[model samples]
Target: MELKKRIEKFKTREFETNKEFYLGIEKGQNPHTLFIGCSDSRVNAEILFQARAGELFQIRNVANIVPRDDDPDNNLSVVSALEYAVKVLKVKNIIVCGHSNCGGCAAIRKLNDYKDDLPNTAEWISQSSRISDYIDGKYPDMNEDNKLVLLEKLNAVRQLDNLLTYDFIRQAFDSRKLNLQAYYYDIGTGDISIYDYENEFSDLIKEIALS
Candidate 1:
């Protein structure tokens, strides 16, 4: 009932008031950025960036994972969108955003436990299992809670490296035609930390990529 009312309100109020703006974009969308964000309800890209319709293209998935170009089990859905965003839409920026307390990241931590139940999810997030392993191996003394937080942040940043594996993306980035960034959104604190493609994890991500 509440959901229906909200839809009704949009039709009667917000939509009607923004009819011109909406109709102007009906012909086509020219988004400036491709926002790859986690499928977390709290991490609303539009709300966070204060962007309106037709301004941002989005690809939301568990843990905001971006499969490497040469990944054996390539995720067609994500890669297709990425290709379209860059080649077709010509988006200038791509932001991969991950959030705190992500269920996907948490699942990656306990992936074996879900292998019998959520097999697909387990496999999907397994791409970032290397990040978890790195965290554990490097910070063996860190508590689980802190480890989870670090994992979430690092996982977000790692996707930037994955994005660069594509030749087209790399060409655009090197030519300064496209900008790549990773964002860690803390829902509780309403804070967002932005990371560049070449970050503190550059060396580590390079080692992992090569390995």
Candidate 2:
């Protein structure tokens, strides 16, 4: 089917089925959480969270990176959305979610493979190379598959850390007005690993809460 047909189908089918939901959306959006995630087609933040309309303010990017607030030359969209969500929307929770089989993380593992041809993508993903450093320093013996998994989890943590670089976020966190979390999602098995900044990744609790 064509894009317009798909949209019309949604308007008549899904939207018609959820008339009240769209009515509330039409009134205004007052999302309670900010979901920062990768732009991968398979990772739909709203679907994964089973979120209703206006429940989540979402920002999706190449690698789900949170560039440092001081990095004025990069990630203006993310920064703007974040400011609006936190400052204007007053979202109480912020989650940085990374996924398995992420092409962006894979590019980091094989940086040389894409650096020459896909320079822009390489530059964007390279911002999260701290995950590579963690892999090197902490899990040097891990196999390629395990390494990618570790990278996926670590990238979420790194982005969470980056979130604190913003003074507003730091203030919100410090005052206990907002919560920050990191999550690693397995696309194949639908498993989600939560990251606790206080402990090593292995020590954190892993859950299989698909519903």
Candidate 3:
């Protein structure tokens, strides 16, 4: 297709224009922080964090899941990356960031809609069914924006709990060698909110803020 061909040509041109910029990344990257976030194009952690190349080691997944340890095939890649970042790279911080209006989070709301066709996704999203219920009851009378905000907060906590199932994460936490943080990005306002582990379902809109 002409559109696909144009994209390839644009990529080549971009590389030629930014050759040195990309080449600096050739030797290696030693990011201080590990960012685990969504695969959503709009929720780019680099852009949100104002992180330049080599400043962030980013791990992205559907629904921003850091699955339990028992899931070898799924958890292996994340675990490997985590181990490399923590043990080898010795990164000081790891952040799990979810976002508002997530299709994955919204899927829990319409589980029955995909009940017959999307078996795997249904099961996968069921991890946050409690999130669905929480959002459901919290914002039943609120607007769509409010409902999405509620889901965003709940998703962060749920994913953080999922991360705790990993031995490496718990070890890191227990040893106080690393700080694990949960966050949510509001695409509508281009704002980030960090999770306060103490205050359930509350976003640290001010204290954990970044420009």
Candidate 4:
């Protein structure tokens, strides 16, 4: 009922007010950025970006994962959007945004617990298992809460490396035709920390890539 009312209000109020803007974009879309974010309900891309309609193309998925080119189980849904965003839309920026208290990232930490009941989720998030293992091995003394936070941030940045595995993405990045960034949004604090492709996690991501 609440959602239906909101939709009705959007049609009667918001749409009427911005009728021209909406109709102008109806013919075609020219979004400037490709925002790849988590499927977390709390992380609303438009609200966070303060963007209007037709401004951003988006891909939302568990843990905000982008499969590497070499990944045998690469999910076509995500890769297809990415390819279209870059090749067809010619989006100048690609932002992979992960957020705090992410259930998906939390699941990756205890993936074995879900392997039986949530097999598909377990397999999907298993892509970032190496990142979790690295944190455990390197920060053995870090508390659970802090470890999760670190994992969330690193996992966001790691997707940038995964994005580079695509030849077209790498070419665009190398030629400065495309910009890739990772963002860690703290839902509670209303803060977002942005990371460039070559950030603190670059070395770690390189090691993981080599492995």
- What candidate 4 gets wrong by more than 4 Å, as runs, is none
Write down the worst ten-residue block by lDDT for model 4: 202-211
- The digit string of per-residue lDDT tens for model 2 on 88-162 reads 999989989999999899899888789899998988888877667657766678788998887788788777767
- What order do candidates take by TM-score, descending? 4, 1, 2, 3
RMSD of each predicted structure: 1.1, 5.5, 5.7, 1.0
Task: Give the deviation of candidate 1 from the true structure as CA RMSD.
Answer: 1.1
Which lDDT tens digits does candidate 3 get at residues 32-135?
89898877888887787887778888788667776666654465777788778877887878888888788877777778887789888777776666666655
Q: Per-candidate TM vs. native?
A: 0.96, 0.90, 0.75, 0.97
Query: In lDDT terms, how accurate is model 1?
Result: 0.92
Which regions of candidate 2 deviate over 4 angstroms? 200-211
Candidate 1, 48-86: lDDT as tens digits:
999999999999999999999899999899999999999
lDDT (10s digit) by residue, model 4, range 78-178: 99999999999999999999999999999999999999999999999999999999899888999999999989998999999999999999999999999
Q: What is the lDDT of residue 193 in candidate 3?
A: 80
Summed backbone clashes in each candidate are 0, 0, 0, 0
Better of 1 and 3 by TM-score: 1
